[model samples]
Target: MSMFAHTETNARSRLPGGKALGGLLQRLGLGGRGLVIAIPTLWLLLFFLIPFLVVAKISLSEAAIARPPYLPIWEWDDGLLNINLNFGNYLFLLEDPLYLSAYLESIKIAGISTLIALLIGYPMAYLIARSPENQRNILLMLVVLPFWTSFLLRVYAWIGFLKANGIINNFLLWTGIIDEPLIMLQTDFAVYVGIVYSYLPFMILPLYANLVKLDQSYIEASADLGARPVTTFLTVTLPLSASGIIAGCMLVFIPAVGEFVIPALLGGPDTLMIGRVLWDEFFSNRDWPIASAVAIVMLFVLVIPIMMLRKAQAVEEGAS
Candidate 1:
């Protein structure tokens, strides 16, 4: 659903060449490839595409708050169908600063958290990638193993650590780091920490995948050419792993933009993200039209970058 909503990426098909391409000519319907292609496509069209179209229609309509509410795109009047698809929901967003600020803050939080995740995750991924062959699998497994447990449980664990009376402060006070427990829990800092911690593995995996493929010869060659370590990194290593970076950024940023769980649980009263706003409107206020409008706006934002990342990956794959 997110993929379809990205508006940023266009789904592309790759065809094999030479004998493989000729084979397609002979057996276009071979095996269950026909169904393999058809079923998911049909499912996406039926479920995702149609639902999104309905939401888009709603976003273009007025916010009708009546019971069993629907903001219709048009109405029947004077024995003719009149198009009343005014952008009231979107216009309201422009008139009010609160909604605009929340959306901007959501993007800022997500972007910064993604950078933080990458900063921490990259060194770990690099270390793991450079480990001995025998130990690498175990290390990689440890990174992924946390996913087997409930995510909610993991976030809940942070509560006990970040809360005012949490164990972390108790230990810190016991050690005399400060006379008082710091105000961490239920703040932006806590939210940032939680997000980075939770999303670290997602950032690490792609980086590891790319790093594992990076030949030491590249570094050796650069060093042998008298390039400084930092110079080599800038000129060679980073550029080579661009695809992985792009992929990881997309994976983290896309979901983080709409994350309600982390902010609602860990964030304080000041945390006003678009995801929370969307949830409030749709479920709490039962303002479906406004909620749908928010969703469309988010979809529009994600469209360009996600598509660019996909295109970059395609180019990288072609080069490989």
Candidate 2:
């Protein structure tokens, strides 16, 4: 009897849940691949899609003097269901020229910052990628060293450098390059400088990753074919690193458009950005509907560029 019981236990262990769980999964058409895909899908649904839907709902509601500060979109009246959705919040945005100017200015600033980062980062990345094996790790570490320090502290340090009678102007004055201090603080130029400094690593890391993997043979062959250095770079290296350029630009531009701290601290009143406007709507004015509308529009604007970049990257990969 003990031997029979032991044999039964082994059989049950081999079969697991007696094939019930396996049969259930098979009937649901959920294989190992499906389970793996479900993780990210579930994550997005929880964190991204759910929050977006909530904001979207708020955007369609009317502002009110209540606990939530927005009128409910639906109500019950005489046993009949009634639904109310307010789109005036969006229309009001179009009617207001301030919002338009804010959007345009944000795009302009972010675009310029991305361009500056690319120009500065490309050379640094190329140098690091081409450096000796012993120095490569150290160079990469230096590139990311800024991240170890607090981001806010770094921005504050920039303030000290850019302020009148600060480090830069003082140095210039001492060198007799200028008789007086330069007005560098609270300006658009200061905003650009701060953004490029903060996001330069994002640009360089992608470029270095892409450039390091590039085959030396293509470059050598080009040089062998009587191509000059510039010609070889323009034809071979540049084309191959297009993916990195797109990725880095997208990373920098997206956050820069919604940047608030750098602009608020470094930029003057003239520096109009959507992020600032959103803050005002949400906090100062306490207009939840308008703020939600502005946020939704901004998301759509950023999404368009992201979709375009992704499509471009896909085409590039397919061609390669």
| True-structure Cα RMSD, model 1 | 10.4
Best by lDDT: 2
- What digit string (tens of lDDT, one per residue) describes model 1 on residues 145-239? 98778888888889999998898999999999889999999898988988888888888998888889898999999999999999998999899
Clashing residue pairs in candidate 1 (N, C-alpha, C atoms within 3 angstroms): 6-303, 7-303, 8-303, 8-304, 8-307, 9-307
66-129 per-residue lDDT for model 2 (tens digits): 8889999999999998999999999999999999999999999999999999999999999999
Q: Relative to the unseen true structure, what is the C-alpha lDDT of residue 187 in candidate 1, on a scale of 0 to 100?
A: 95
RMSD of each: 10.4, 4.8
TM-score for each of the candidates = 0.85, 0.86
Clashes of 1: 6
Off by over 4 Å in 1: 1-37, 65-67, 75-79
Whole-model lDDT values for every prediction = 0.85, 0.91
